[model samples]
Target: IAVMTVLLIVVGLTACGKSTAQDLQSNKWYPNQKGQSYKTQFNKKTMIIESPLMNVNANYSVSNTSGKEYLKVNTDDEKNQKLELTQISDGYKAKAINKPAKADDGLGSFE
Candidate 1:
């Protein structure tokens, strides 16, 4: 019984953690301040700006009248900083911008 309880607790915690992460990703935007622009198209008639340059490492799941889309900015240590762009229109456009990695004293890692 004790073992079962512990396992349940672990699974619950893991599930909660994943849920939190998804929420964060869905709403990740740093330069989320006012007046900055980050525009991506939802279709021919709709354009959405999930965040701004100030939103340095924000992730977002954008849904518009057309469809759903995802965006995430890369900021992991040991990896190059880049703007991870993703869009799915008639086809799709996905790419990254390469930039020099920053020094963080070896205490951080990118994912």
Candidate 2:
């Protein structure tokens, strides 16, 4: 009698778990679109010469331009820059605008 009771309890729990999972899967959550803009700040001091060592503030905006969707990122720092990324098949792609030239290692080869 105890073994039968334990088996019934286990079966009930399994059914409850499956039902909860299905309910969660049927309901999808999406972000709010009421002109919401996300902002982020970063301050870092790096020993590596390749990395930037400064305080930076970035703002992200999502909107549609000319019927195409884009994610815009604006940064305020030494190199004040703006980037607009467009969604591609595999990932996003953005053109490098107003970028500085690569430094040469004095041997005509880029470092």
Model 1 residue 85 CA deviation (Å) reads: 19
Q: Model 1, range 1-111, lDDT digits (tens) per residue?
A: 999999999999976763322433344222211343353323222223344343222223333224333333323332333333333333233333343222442112122
What TM-score, computed on C-alpha atoms, does each candidate reach? 0.27, 0.29
lDDT of 1 at 81: 33
lDDT (Cα, 0-100) at 40 in candidate 2: 22
**Clashes in model 1: which pairs?**
28-58, 28-59, 30-55, 31-54, 31-55, 76-110, 77-109, 77-110
Q: Which stretches of candidate 2 lie over 4 Å from their true place?
A: 1-57, 78-81, 96-111
Candidate 1 local lDDT, residue 47? 23
**80-100 in candidate 2: lDDT tens per residue?**
232344544443443333332
RMSD (CA, angstroms), candidate 1: 14.1
- Number of the top candidate by TM-score? 2
